[model samples]
Target: MEYQESFINYLRYEKRTSPHTVVAYKKDLDQFVCFITEMVGEFDVNKVDSKLVRTWIVSLMEKQLSPRSVNRKVSTVKAFFRFLMKEKIVETNPAVNLPLPKVRKKLPGFVEEESLHHLLDDGFFPGDFRGVRDKLIVALLYATGIRLAELMQLKGSSFDTKNYLIKVLGKRQKERIIPYPREMNNLLFEYLEIRNREIGYFPDILLVTEKGKPVYEKLIYRVVKKSLEYVTSFEQKSPHVIRHSYATHLLNKGADLNAVKELLGHSSLAATQIYTHTTFEKLHDIYKQAHPRG
Candidate 1:
């Protein structure tokens, strides 16, 4: 447990991982520790071996965990062992060179552009403070393709109003500037006016509740879900769907893939390539419809 705590601190303080990621790492480590203690009658980092890690993976598979989930657990174990090796608490890494389960790729889900247009432009959102804020939430997500975490961390200072650009702090504390549509400026100004006039107090943070308190994760989810319910019937109507919609819409309109990757703040183009699959599917449908042979 001491070694685990030290590694967790290393992730939090030195690596500066997000709180959500740190919590996930801690849970994965705890599960691994429990498995080790049960299998060997004791928990000693030095005594762990590749065979034991394989056995743990087998046990996770037996529990009917999905391949992607099992792979994530394997990655967690591998990372933990690497951390131990770096700290000199363990002389060897136990989980190195371990094989992960194969996962079938699923194309990201996205709402159609027409549906989003109806949602945003068809009087779906009311004309009040909360309504305008909710509209902005959906608009900014589609316009800028920012993640939920990035949206939550946005402040007034993060915006370059003159340039129609927003600075987003993405994964690993990397920052990128994304340009929003010019139409979003009106919604932003209106939300600010109502927020200040009604709440009567302004914080550094941009989005706040009716009570002027900082919004939370669940609240953001609820806001997105509730508003999307009026427009999309897709089972997954979370903020990420809006992000996917943003990327898909951009690609369908012939936006450059590399430009999209940079706008999304992706570490590699591969992470941004999934949206191309969605675009390809759209082209396939068009080809099927317009082909002379058909």
Candidate 2:
């Protein structure tokens, strides 16, 4: 337990991991510790071996967890053991050489451009403050490719209106700037006018409730879901779907991959490449429809 606490501190302070990630790691480690204690009458990190790790993996699978989720748990264990090895608390890494289950990558779902255009262009939003705020939320998410947390933390000062770029604080507190369209600038100016009248500028956050408080996750999700339902029949309609649509649309329009990666505040090109699968699917359809051989 002492070693586990040290490892968590290392992740939190030294690694600068996000709070959400630290909580997940701690949860996974606690579960592993509990499993080991139940099996051996007491938890002992040194007693852990590959066989014991395999037993726990089997137990997790029997609980009907998805392979992807199980794999993540196993990775957490591996990271902990690696930390233990580095600290000289354990000489052998029991989590090492554990085979992970293969996970199928599902292409991210996105709203079609025409559907989004229909929703935005056809006056689906109302003229009220709530309507304008909700509409701009959807537009900003799709336009900037910023994550929900980033949007939540957004401040009014983050916008460089004359430069037409907004600054985003991404995972691990990394900051990046993304430029928006000229028309989006106009929408933002209008939203600000409504925001000033409704909320009275007390919060100073870029996005606020009509009551002058910062927006919470559930409210954001509800806003995005309700707005998306009018035009998209996609099974999943969350803020992330809007973000996925943002990346996919950019790639479909011939935006460079690296440029999109930077714009989306991704740490690696690999993380940003997932959207290319959707773009390729579009190209395949167009080829089939336009080729003379068909």
Candidate 3:
């Protein structure tokens, strides 16, 4: 228990892991400790063996957990034991020999370009501050393809309107600049005007609540979901869906893979390469419909 807490703190303060990642690692570790305690009547890190770890994997599979979820949990166990090994508290790493299940790769979901066009150009958003702010939220996510956390962490000065770029602090605190349309810059300026009038003063943060406080994750999720429902019928209407649309659309329009990778703040080209699959699918569809080989 002490070790788990210390590991979590290490992830939080030292590794600078995201809050969502830290929470997931904590949950996985807690479940593993519970499994060990129930089987051996005590949770001793040194007492853990490959057999015990295998049994826990079996239990997770029996519960019908997806292979990907099971694999992530296994990764948590491996990371934990690695820490113990480094601290000289464990003689052998039981999780080292533990096997993981293979996970299926699913294509990312995205809204169609026409649907997004209608949503933004049509009379979907309101004329009030909330409407302006909500529309701007959707615009920024789709236009720049930044992650939700990066948008939430945006500051008033994050935008360089003259240069047509917005600086984003992405994962691991790595910073990158993404260009935006001149139209989006004007929209943002209008939103800030309304925000200033409503709050009676400018807040240091961007994308704040109606009351002028910094926006949280859930609120942004709701804003994106609700705004998207106005134009599309997709089941997944999260901010990430908009991000996927941004990437897929860029690739569909013949944007360079490496250039799209930079806009999305992906650490590697491999991560951005997934959009190519969707782009190829679209091209195949067009070929099937337009080709007259028959």
Candidate 4:
């Protein structure tokens, strides 16, 4: 367990992993330690073997944990063991070459373009500061496809209003510039005016609470979920779903794949390619309706 703390510190300070990621890794390691302790009456770094590790995997599967979750936990153990090897605390990494469960990929869910347009264009949002801010939040996520973390870090300084661009700090602190529609300029200006009048010019943070504090994750989720309820009956309505809609809609409009990859701030094209499946499904539906050969 001492080594677990050290490994976590390594992830935090050395690898510069995100706080969210560090917390998840810590939780997985803690769960693994509990399993080992209950099984052998004690957890010894040297005493752990592949069989014991495999047994833990079996236990997780028996509990009906999804393959993706099991794979993530397995990766946690494997990384911890590799760290132990580097520190010379162990000779052989018991988790080395351990087989991972196969994960079934699911298509990303997105709202139809028409529903989103109706929601934004129909004046569903109220005219007050809170309503304007909430509308901009929904619009920004759908328009730019930035993640929740990136949205939280946005500032008035992050925008290039003249050029209709937003600078986003994405995963791993990587920075990318994304452009929004010129039409959104009016909405942005309106939100800023109301925000300044009500919240007193907190230029350092673009979005804020009614109490003048920067908005947090739950607030953002609530704004997105509530706004989405009017436009979509989808069981899942969150910022990322808007993000998925952003990417899928772009691809459906014939945007270049590599260009979309950059817009979404994906490190590789493979991640951006998933939206193509959604696009293909749309084309298939259109084909079924339009093509009638007698």
Best by lDDT: 4
Candidate 2, 1-294: lDDT as tens digits: 898899999999998887778999999999999999999898888888899999999999999999989998999999998998898888988887877778999889999988887877789999888988888888889879889988888887888989889998888779898998778888888988888877677445888887888999999999999998999889999989988999999999999999999998888999899999999999999999999984
The clash count of every prediction, one per candidate, is 0, 0, 0, 0
Candidate 4 residues lying further than 4 Å off, grouped into runs, are none
lDDT (C-alpha) at residue 192 in model 1: 88
Ranking by TM-score: 1, 3, 4, 2
User: In candidate 2, how many Å is residue 148 off?
Assistant: 0.9
In model 2, where do residues sit more than 4 Å from their true spots?
A: none
Which candidate has the top score in TM-score? 1
Specify the poorest-scoring 10-residue window by lDDT in model 1: 195-204
Clashing pairs in 2: none
Candidate 2 at 152: error in angstroms?
0.7
lDDT of all predictions:
0.90, 0.89, 0.90, 0.93
Compared with the true structure, what per-residue lDDT tens digits does model 3 show for residues 189-209?
899898888865654688888
Q: Which residue segments of model 1 deviate by more than 4 Å?
A: none
CA displacement after TM-score superposition, residue 159 of candidate 1 (Å): 1.1
Q: How does candidate 1 score on lDDT? A: 0.90
Query: Which candidate, 1 or 2, has the higher TM-score?
Result: 1
- Per residue, candidate 1 scores C-alpha lDDT tens digits across 225-269 of 998899888999899999999999999999999999999989899
Q: What would you estimate as the lDDT of candidate 2?
A: 0.89
**Which 10 consecutive residues of model 3 have the lowest summed lDDT?**
199-208
